[model samples]
Target: MKKTNLSFIKPLAFAIATVGLMAGCGSDDSNSSSSAATSTVVDSEDNQLAFDATAYTTVNISLDGVTMAVRQYRIVYVANPIEMASQSAFGSTMLLDDPYIYQTMIVSVAEASVSDENTALYFKVNNAGWFTSAVATDITEGAEFVSTSDTDAVGAALKAGYVFIDVGTRSRGARAVDGSWAGKAPAPVVDAKAAIRYLRLNDALMPGSAERIVVTGTSGGGGLTAAVSASGNSADYLPFLAAVGAAGVTGEDDSLASTINDDVFAAVAYCPINNLGNADAGYEWQYNGIRSDDNTGSLNGVAYSAGVQPAASAAIAALFPDYLNSLNLTLDDSSALTDATMNSAIVEQLKEELERQLAAGTDVPDYGEDFSVTLRGTTYAIANDWLTLSGSGTSATVADIDFEKFLKFVTTPIALKTVVAFDAVGVTGNPNISGETNLFGSDSYEYANFTQWSWNNNEVLGDGSGTDDTGLAWSDYLASTSELATQLKLINPIAYLNTDADSAPYWYVRHGMIDRDTAYAMQLTLYYAIKNDKSVRDVSFKMPYLTPHSGNYDVQEAFSWIKTKLDAGI
Candidate 1:
């Protein structure tokens, strides 16, 4: 065994202080300095441990075209990992543990840079081994990169001078939230764009020749990577260009298409989600069999509605009294409500009441606790009654309105009008609209429905005027080949290092494997979809049969593979 000198004394002291601070001032204090000091110490320790800190360089690139500013951290490298031990363990029949290690880095960005040219790379790892909190902390501290090395892939990347980026947005919390992913896209897309921007601006962030750039993720992150790649007009999506444009900041053009096709080379994605429109297709639903199950004209008797329910709305109204007392919004003057409608007047009154209470800035009720009552009531009613109420009638008007709301809530595309207009252009080629054919087909009720949904929503958002239905159709068009092909192309580049029959590139895919996740199936689909695409075949896909979803062996194997890739220049 290779014994490396380990130090527990300094970290132990910091840990003691952390505990003391947590006990003394509570963990949420914004001004806590001890944690910052400890972090600095850890950074120094990491620098001492690794002599070649200059192996990686950090850069900040802005995203253009949106109302927000975006940044990214890019880690560029060349090489592939060598295979290590592979065996069947954990839930996966294909478990692998690659011992090869690497360095880690991070690139953070803002939300505005999401687009085809400026893309971010979000990385997710398993719960153990490299995924360990200590390891993740070490990587972040050492590289000044935002990362969580809780899995084999991440650890391996870190050791190989690869920077790891956490995909979840800051708003969604650094860690995964427990509720349904109610937001449109996962947090990873934002982070991925940020990473790409970072890399484009700073080329000194990787070891060896910092030439080609690739983006990859696993599981959920993989899904996001696929989405980013698919959403692009160029070979690589430059999300930062849009961000920069939106920020009123002028600089060199760092469009993804320019960087990817011209500068940054290649992309990699693992277990990607190709069909967002059909995300629910094969998903298990007890009441509906599978979401893909066709039940034309059959009602599930579930009522759905938009916005808050009447009862919850009433409860929120009731809370006004208590809120008013807390906010001191009581009627000091009714002059502001003279020209407002009844409902509008009431709302204005409440707003004024709240403003008054806050203005004193003396004694205030707990906003969280005070708001919880209204929120709880509204949520309860909406959850229990909205579905039934919204879907109650069969009239075309009712159906149309309900569907419209559903579309608005589900797919809030950025440039709704442009997407719609783009789709309308496609309709000239296929004019038929009937329910009998597949919805995604050229002339089907599905197309018409989507078109109407898109148009109405576009009108609502007031951004552009185009056919919303067309965007959905376009997504379907790409789903057949482009999406899957892009994903396969990315993951294919990394060579499998572990020789164990159950290792990656093989284990996660080969039929009948117990540990195979949806990603494996997706890979297979993409493989068959574009087996003939020249741009795709150049990529490689390595598989092993003995890797489990948990444990140190798996982590070791993944790390080894990443190291191999970094070394081999694949």
Candidate 2:
């Protein structure tokens, strides 16, 4: 087990201080020194663009008049008032539903009461691992905050005076309105970038500063947020963005006065389920200690749970160190941590989560917990043939044993996915598997999701690897690999953390330690990369103990962080 040699990551000491949390968290903003010295918060003016944030009481954009409603808009940097805003036109699912017809983004400016011209645009999207197919064609009408109350994050942002823009992006589950498989991997990512471009291009007409646009999302959307942050100003989405009428698309040669850029100021992702390529290995390593067995923690009364095809799990876990070693990582102290030790950081994160949840009064069932009960019907386990009773009551203490066994007692087995996981080794397409594979699926929405597995295994036709072009194998593999590499880089934030790709310097990442959906290592790799990158001054990432694959524990804390960044103009 080699160590992850990154000199920028925070040490356990930092974690200790963070776990203890600062008093008046909303007011105490000194926890993360990195954010205080964030690099992007410069005093230099960026005049390359030809727009400025102003106010608009009417709709400012329309897709052949596709939008059915208008969220909010403003006018600035323009001598004439522009009005054509409609919300229903921004299409998702399939970009090519019409030759020039595509999705529209519900642009929001500050509320009618807000007069701050320095306010910034905030994009909020949470489609999760699955794609969201809305209920109405005129989705713009839905962006308005009518009778319904805003959620935690949304409400917090509104109170902070942010102009929230809810984007309508296609996801893996998106099917063409014409019943075709058009919305695929690149579609959602492409649309996401396009939405940002729309905000930036029409900056003069929006209420807030487009240059300071902030983005937030959860799960897969969180992954998208990270990717967009990393892929800022990347040329990869230009062709698609142009086709979607995002940047200065007026008619033929005619166009609107816009920047045509998709850059953002900051990003926040919650349990971003990304880095799919190495997820299996991360999963195996995470659950390596626990054995597979019925509830009592006994294998034929031997006081030990069996492993999950131990050999297979080990084979996958063994690959993790190599991947970790390949990353050019560093720690905050400028010291190198081997991949093995870096992995231990993840384990500690898990332990911290368990303790956190327990303290929160959450019913955390773990071996470390003192109280236990004689759970009936093989529910509780007796470790080392011992169960400690807690004085008089029916409650008992969980039999102390190996930590792995205790984790297993709490989480059961990690059988949610297949042994090979997302790539589907022998399977022809994403339809072969139920989840992530499908998210990567394309072409027919039923197949075409195999990227990494095919690149390694599929013998490209006459290449003499014992595979042939019986079903377009060679052609399919080539196209699949191209899409795979491109989309993987486009969506996986981990893929560009060290690259020159323009990205959001300020980031707030949250991953639930108890989330076994994918390996926590995938998330930590980003943390390690950011901490190691001296160029970035602001980043706050954490795992809520025992939390599921979700977040929003302290929206006010995030708001506080964002407030500081906003004040600093980062």
Candidate 2, residues 73-118, lDDT tens digits: the string is: 3111111101111211222223332211123344454345245556
RMSD of each: 26.6, 14.2
Model 1 residue 496 CA deviation in Å: 24
**Model 2 stretches astray by more than 4 angstroms:** 1-102, 113-115, 130-151, 177-180, 248-259, 288-315, 333-338, 350-410, 413-416, 424-433, 441-445, 451-481
**Cα RMSD for candidate 2?**
14.2
Residue 345, candidate 2: Cα error in Å is: 1.1
Stretches off by above 4 angstroms in model 1 are 1-151, 165-191, 205-214, 227-240, 244-270, 279-522, 537-570
Over 120-239, each residue of candidate 1 has an lDDT whose tens digit, in order, gives 222432211111111122233223321234344433443334434542221111111222111112223322333333333222222222233444544444444444433322322233
Local lDDT at 4 for model 2: 24
Which prediction has the highest TM-score against the true structure?
Answer: 2
Worst-scoring 10-residue span by lDDT in model 2: 75-84
The backbone clash count of each candidate, in order, is: 117, 42
